[model samples]
Target: MQASHTLAELEAVLGEQVKKLRLSRNVDQTLLAERAGISRRALQNLEAGTGSSVASLLSVVRALGREDWLSLLAPATTINPLTMVRARRERQRATSVRAKSPTAK
Candidate 1:
């Protein structure tokens, strides 16, 4: 389905994927947590979609030999010439306005 989901739903989906990946690799939760340098409870919480820190998530993904996933989370930013021009013009307008505003003595 191409339907959009809530943030909680997205987290739940990610948690399930992590759990499945761990199982497919024959890794137990305790072992995975130890390898990720996190507590077993943290892993559990992550799998349950309750809560998790970004560091913890990265650790777990790395422990699973999936560091490449980080790229998917944050793609490289590229400059847009049009946007840059628009921002520059906007800044110039703002500077002119401040210069013309009467100062309070």
Candidate 2:
């Protein structure tokens, strides 16, 4: 089963990621916020680990030219292995029934 976390916690994690990326890139938050067209206060909220919209983060990310990381940060998808195994078995059975006679080899 999958577990869930609060928006606040998720935001905190994202904020930390942003702070690390920004510092690693040697850019200050003010310049980043200005380029993103957001108030410095909003940027501060992000850095301070307050819950904010993904759009807000994306705006800052684009402003910082770090938009490439979005794909990397997508939520992980869970798989039901039992259901998949059943489906695979069903498909194999169907395939066996639908199989054509072997052509002259």
Candidate 3:
């Protein structure tokens, strides 16, 4: 998908994909909604790209056997080698000498 696309455009594309998947599986809105534990209207809204809750979207995708696709939204975190090297080179504690008070002089 193009980064330049608007949010609505992206939502429409996602809705189309979900609708296609459901059709391919021979599942109707009611049946899919039932399996997903969501209302049929919720499924319709999702398929129509009107709007949907994240919970509803996840439920429908899980019911459609596409939960794996959600993982792409948040991949595993990897440590940065440059950051690790810099951390190793940095001092862990301050060791500066304190100034003597005027009264001590």
Give the candidate number with the greatest lDDT: 3
Instruction: Put the candidates in lDDT order, highest first.
Output: 3, 1, 2
Q: Which candidate leads in TM-score?
A: 3
Q: Roughly what TM-score does model 1 have, to 2 decimal places? A: 0.70
Q: How far in Å is the alpha carbon of 59 misplaced in model 2?
A: 0.7
lDDT winner between 2 and 3, please give it: 3
- In model 2, what are the clashing residue pairs, if there are any? none
lDDT of 1 by residue, 1-105 (tens): 135887778778888989999999999999999999999999998988888888889999999999888998699899999989887733433333454447665
For 1-105, candidate 3 gives per-residue lDDT tens digits of 899999888888999999999999999999999999999999998998889989999999999999888989998789999988887866779999999998996
Give candidate 2 misplaced runs (Cα > 4 Å). 1-4, 73-105
- Write out the backbone clash pairs for model 1: none
TM-score of predicted model 3?
0.80
**Residue 11 local lDDT, model 2:** 71
Off by over 4 Å in 1: 1-3, 78-105
Better of 1 and 2 by lDDT: 1
Q: What are the lDDT scores of the predictions, listed in order?
A: 0.88, 0.79, 0.93
